[model samples]
Target chain A: MNLQVSRFQFFSIVLNFIIYSSILMAPGITVINAKQDGWLSMLLALGVGLAANFLYLMLFKKHGYPSLFELMDRSAGKWIGTALNIVIVFYALHLTAMVVRNLSNFMITDVSPYSSPYIYQILILLVVAYTSYHGVKNLFLISELFTPFISLFVIGSLIVIIKHFKIIELKPFFYNPPSAILEGAYSTLGFPFIEIMLAGAFLTYVKRKDKLVSIALSAIAIGGAVLVITVILVIGNDSAYIVARESYPTYSVMRDVSLTTTFKRVEIIIGIAWIIGLFFKISTCFCVAMMGIKHLSKSKTFRGYIVPCAILVWAMSNGLHKTFIDFTNFVSMDWTLYWFTLYSFVIITMLIGLARKRA
Target chain B: MQDWKTTMKANKTTREKIVLAIVWGFSLYYIIGYLAGIDPFPITVWLKAIYGPIYHTLFGG
Candidate 1:
């Protein structure tokens, strides 16, 4: 199968992957942890996230196509390699389930309280399954087309609400305890950022392997800036207390914007951009999981596994949490450590492979 | 019965066939269960069933 994607398409995929669900929810977690210094926390997290990306790039340079799975195989023999592959596949599926659940919860809580969560759950899973069946080329084709509109609407919303931004909301910047900033950084690093580990699964398919590092770095930097600006805007407009209290601070801040006396409730723009971004996000995560399954099982075709995988993701999404609070608490408290542990495993495996190459 | 069993064995590797059967079988079972409005087995059951004792022994969670 021709899975090759261009530099621009790959960039769009990575950018959409980072911003999709994070824009809606990350600011709240940042504010809750770092208070007025939430932007700084994101900055710190971005630096750490970039360093992780550098590690991925190093692995890619050494072991080109097939990415992390190949690196694991080279680092360890067949038995251990297959075992690690299973673990990586599980992690990808878990992350995909979390994303699916996050979007489902957003719709239930903010968009439609009366609707059954299963409706959105099945609908999204069907869409994701269909996209994954067609493979990465078609997936990122939609990403490349929709990415512009998502970016335009996001930037437009920021401009519309530009006047409401207040300096006072960020006054006590350094006042947060060191632990708060560190926790916030850790959480941000785990989410939306280090989660680019999913993108590593696709790096092999990039037609211009030479541009991989630059493109990935640029995407991360752009995504980080958008996140920082989002934090600033959310805290600036609504105050850190309001941003922290709200379930979706970025969306809530957009809700408060009014372009003119006659115009109101412009948060709808934010919703439109976010929903579009999430389509690509969910698709990317599902694709990564599909890739993992193919590699682990040595399957010639991924299509056969798509339906079963989507069903498993849907089941996990539904069964995982009873309420949104539990979900967010998991994200803030445990998710970072869980995510970093998996990432560190991959990096360690790669480092071992690199050392052996030299030896 | 002997002919059918011979044919099945000739068509695929045992591992491939087993994986296929598991995938399709579990998928169909889950679909039927979902349509019938059967709640999924509680997530915590497995988490606790498996991880609970591990955590208790390792970190005493």
Candidate 2:
């Protein structure tokens, strides 16, 4: 087990983790709450998200036992550390379920309406399981390979659609109060921003830890910038009232892009890119969850849990929400605060553990 | 080794094989039940019950 990934690969990991499911939905999620000034909310989340990234980095001690799970044990003693690990494991698994559901919902609602979501779920799950079977580095390598395609397709679509951005869509910018805008940021702050910390659980395997901070924070910056631009472009091109109503607004906005008489259907490219992103995301979460179980059980190999975890993720995805609307309701309203609360719990425990070490 | 669990392996222990079987059984119970159109309990029931009061209160019923 001499596994180690380069900072470049780690950057790809964080980059994929940051933008995954957020690329399409972030605009709609923000606009729904903050109305026309939704990009502002995204900017606000980016600022907080970067600061949270800094705080997460600070939690990684420079000395021995730099791993977060190890740090928990060193700080809080055995039981609390184990408990914290369990919390992360559950969060990772649940988040995997959520991502699986997200992709399935997108395919069902936006792509093909007649198919059962489980069909999509099982298809992705099998690949995710195979990725897990190959290990975390495989996920990282694939992220590195696929990231450019996702970014290129996404940004290219944005560039093509930029000419359509009528500043009129952003008129009456401050119509939503600060509280409403803040609510928009709050909904997404946990989703696209905080979930990057999941990479921290496994990044200790990076051989050269120097510049980890720069790599991760820059991923946050780039990911958030892409998201903010998407918000502006989509809302700028389409009405907030209308974009806010759609499940995947950016995709729909991209759907209307026409390079010429023969060159439309940009949404399909974005759709495929999204699948790649979701694949990386689901694989990463599955790996993280497997790590949590491995750490807790002191198992000889976490790869052994891959199949079990994949099946559970598939099961959980199918079982979590009865309808796509329910999933959206959870995401827009509860997703942020839920992750927000969980991060608070983990942060407080870490702080207490750090203080205990000082004493 | 920190990497042992995360690095892919080519072989599995007997215990892991057994665990896999058990997991397959557990999953089949739900997957088959769902295909048969039997969903006794969904995760949303518990999730809604827990966060129900909060988000429901804010967003309305």
What is the Å distance of residue A276 in model 2 from its true position? Answer: 0.5
Single out the weakest 10-residue window by summed lDDT for candidate 1 chain A.
Answer: A62-71
CAPRI accuracy category, model 2? acceptable
Quote the positional error of residue B57 for candidate 1 in Å: 18
User: Interface RMSD (Å) of model 2?
Assistant: 3.1
For model 1, state the Cα shift of residue A289 in Å.
1.1
Best by DockQ: 2
lDDT of 1: 0.80
lDDT of candidate 2 over A1-359, digit per residue (tens): 46688888888878777776698889888998899999999999999999987887776643332666776776678988878887787789889999999998899899998898889999999998888888777887888787887889877888998978999989887888898888889878989798877888766788887777887899889888988988998999888999988889989998888888888786888898889888888888888878776666656667656776776677778777777788887887777767777777767777887777677
Judged by whole-model lDDT over C-alpha atoms, candidate 2 comes out at 0.80
Query: Which CAPRI level is candidate 1?
Result: incorrect
Per-residue lDDT over B1-61 for candidate 1, one digit per residue giving the tens place of the 0 to 100 score: 9999897558656666666676667656665665566745554444445544543453223
lDDT of 2 by residue, B10-48 (tens): 345555565556546766776666566666346567666
TM-score, chain B only, every model? 0.49, 0.57
After the best TM-score superposition of candidate 2, give how far the Cα of residue A119 lies from its true spot, in angstroms: 2.1
